[model samples]
Target: MGVFSTTSRYSLAFLVMMNLCLKAMASESDIDFSFKNFGKVEPHLALYGDAEVNNHSSSIQISGSTNFSAGRLIFRKPINLVGANPRTMVSFSTYFAFSISGENGDGLAFVVLPVEFPLNIFDGGSMGLLRDRKIKFLAVELDTYMDKTYNDVNNNHVGLDIETPVSVKVGNLSSVNLVLNNGEKLQCWIDYEASGKRIEVRVSKFGETKPVDPLLFYYPLDLSQMWGDEKNGVFVGFVSSNGNSSQKISIHSWSFKSRMPPPRWMHSEPLDPDNVVEIKGEEGIRSIPKRSDCTSRVVLALVFGAGCGVIVAFFIVFVWIVVGSKRPVAPEELAGKGNEFEYKKFGEERAIKDGDGNGEK
Candidate 1:
């Protein structure tokens, strides 16, 4: 009995240790955030500058200023840019919904920086990012206004910035012709593939599906080298700024996955049109339906209707033929001398009369 009890205790201890190790490894592999409401957010989220939680709408307003304001929201927990095994790097993807209103001056960016917690940065056109030679970071900027100093391609564009405000590459937002400060909400997707060291950014109107082509694509970025020898991880968050003309920048929803094409095990809510905010003066800018999908639907409807009509016509014709065959022959036509039935009856009566006459004789 003593031997059995000792073996059971050892087995239970081994199982507990294995469970703990598995959990730790899983947490390192992925990080997911769903900002449905502030109450549900993890305690690690640190809000800095003008950022605040709006309980009425359940969104985080990063910056709302007419003069000059800045805001930053950073996750306190550091994420490994490269996995535990140095040879394999960790890939990441993110989806977010945001809106800019009023006179849009500057813009907002999603950033991964090697800075410590409680970051206080510059405002205005800088987008609240710290500009220091020693600071290393990567940013995907959604710029709204043109800056001559940066050689901006257009007022509305997306850019990839590495270690400096000047973009290494930029893609013009040709689809958006209207002023972005019109209170229109937009959604964006960012994907980073570690193996290829490539990054892609896609944008679409809020509540619409993602576009097939990416607006910005940058390749050959060495994430491991970007982290530098001193750092093996970085903090992820958002930063926004406004200049003389300001706007209200808010994040309605956000999600992050630590793997490319996000695994099925991760749970995130799909975009819902009913939850999207209706913007005025946006009717003209609504997305048009795809030609192929519209054509297919119309063709299917016509084929189905034609098939039903043919079946109904055949049923009507069959019913008419059946009714005509059952109709009785008219009595006037049957009594005519040329009728076969009338002739047979007359012969039978004559034969019976002849028999009667012979008996009388």
Candidate 2:
């Protein structure tokens, strides 16, 4: 029994430690980042449609009077999906080269979605490029119109995005940096139109350009692999949609190419397990969540110790009363009534109590 108890104690301790490790890992997986934007122009996009990359210039200007719930303008180019995921982490910062001809209700959106190679147009800003894998590169939208579909509080708010299950807001404005690097990071900022007077924004691929600020991302990439298909390349372009209230936005230029990012990590499938949650810092920085660790251990020790102490105290009191108190002089009816009570005695305490009562002064 002693040996068994010893093994059980250690086993329980190990299990608790393992549970802590698992919880830490699960929390780590939940850390993510996203972005924000301002409505400078209506939402628009470029559908690589039948446009010949060799024949046409890479950019196009969309012109229209804005007074509709929404509309789409697409400028498409054919490109590649380099890494493991045809999808790449996309970040966009939008600017209005010129202002809205009318401003009561006007907004703009930037998008990267797949379109049928010829040309694909659905209800502008409605399908939001529905189910069109070719035209839908995960998109960033600046919207001014509110529909029941978006559940917007009003047309003034901005949002971060997700397509399949639902679309939700992330940040609000005219100028914002929107980033999506998988689920772990989705960050954004929307520039207030009031502040638009003195604003400048830039977008580049940390692709070919060396970024002063580096971004680490994972893509369906093949560094040294061979590729045979030309259409398989990535396509990126600008898009806009206008509401019944018209707005025009001009994009000066945009660029894309690959650049070396900071060292990053990926756990291979069926990965070897020790601690799956990642924590990075200065080389010598403490590697744990200090306050959390301290509080958790303190709380756990108090809980376990308090619980065990209460139980042990109760057991001791029970045993002491059994051994230290007159054992009820064995109630006459229960005395020796069962095998376990076979040696029980009758009531001496009752007789003593009756005598004492009669003699009370």
Candidate 3:
């Protein structure tokens, strides 16, 4: 049939060039912004020191009372945290909406460092991080100062800073009556679950709802040892300080998201190896297909090549209907007629006359 319509038009132009090369390798350098109302800021955000932007209430103040103030706001790109496989790790979530008033003396974090770090190394109780020590971070703070030198679990807590500043899990905002420095507007959340290397934290009091537990939990955090793999990338914002008291710190609304870890055939449940916490040279936390794409392996290879071309066209129409039913021919072999041949009528007479002469024309 015109060579199967020229082999189905070269297999649909090779599946549209393999679906544009799997959408450019499952392209995803994800990071989403929301800022419901930071009015104008956003020049891809990367404010440093005393961060600003408060067009009459479209908040963002991040550290003001001054006494040795410091601030940051980050997000000038570096995202990717992990996905083109490199020992898989990539999952995130964030939300913000802060507020803290004066006299709290230090606190406010949520970092993830290493994107050439040094936005000017910080000081004063580590909220603005990097009091150097071979810098490496991954914070969450929100402290409010009680610093007995990093052992603070009092001035309204919620910690989890991993490359030091001491808190290896703290959370205790007066057990939930919530009071960070009392200026009101709270709300925080943080998630990260590259298949249960887990991490979760939550808080409330802004518009409420979104607190089904998790007031801090950290476990096996193998964020690929914090940016030393998957081709390095990491830099997600917010930091603050006001150490010797004079604290302000505002920051109204914010958002963040990241993903990549779903393809275990789209998992339908089975990740409870006792709530997975296997870390120690990590590996095997299964789930790989968030991005770095193959468009679901090219849509399952075009549905397995159209179901194997409809099972090879139904096995070539079942061998052409069993060779066209043995090509027809048996009505008693077309009514048996051939054997009556010797009907030499006109020849009979000539033969009789010429028989004796042994020849006849």
Cα displacement (Å) at residue 49, model 2: 11
**Candidate number achieving the greatest lDDT relative to the actual structure:** 3
- For 1-361, candidate 2 gives per-residue lDDT tens digits of 5445555565577679869996674433122221122223223333331211111322223323334433344433343323333222212233222122234333444443343423354344442244334232333443444555667544433443443313443333323343221111122222211111111123222223333432222222222222223334434444444444444433333333322121112112222224233466776433443555557558877887888799789656754554554333666888656754433333566677889999995
Give the whole-model CA lDDT for all candidates, comma-separated: 0.74, 0.37, 0.77
- lDDT comparison, 1 vs 2, better candidate: 1
Q: So what's the TM-score on candidate 1?
A: 0.62
Per-candidate Cα RMSD to the true structure, in Å, reads 22.6, 23.2, 18.4
Model 1 C-alpha lDDT per residue in residues 1-361, reported as the tens digit of each score: 5444554565577669869997787677677766644534458788888888877767788887446778887877777766665655678888888888857667889999885533875523387786444567789988887888888888788889988888999988776453455678888899988766789999888888888888888877768777634244788889987766667888888887785223222323233344444445746545443556457558877887798799788656755554544545657855665667778988999999999999999
Q: How well does each candidate superpose onto the true structure, as a TM-score?
A: 0.62, 0.36, 0.31
Pairwise TM-score winner, candidates 2 and 3: 2
Per model, how many backbone clashes are there?
0, 69, 2
Task: Give the distance in Å from residue 255's predicted Cα in candidate 2 to where it truly belongs.
Answer: 3.6
For model 2, the superposed segments whose C-alpha errors exceed 4 Å read 1-63, 66-76, 84-101, 104-106, 115-118, 127-136, 164-166, 174-231, 260-361
The candidate that wins on TM-score is 1
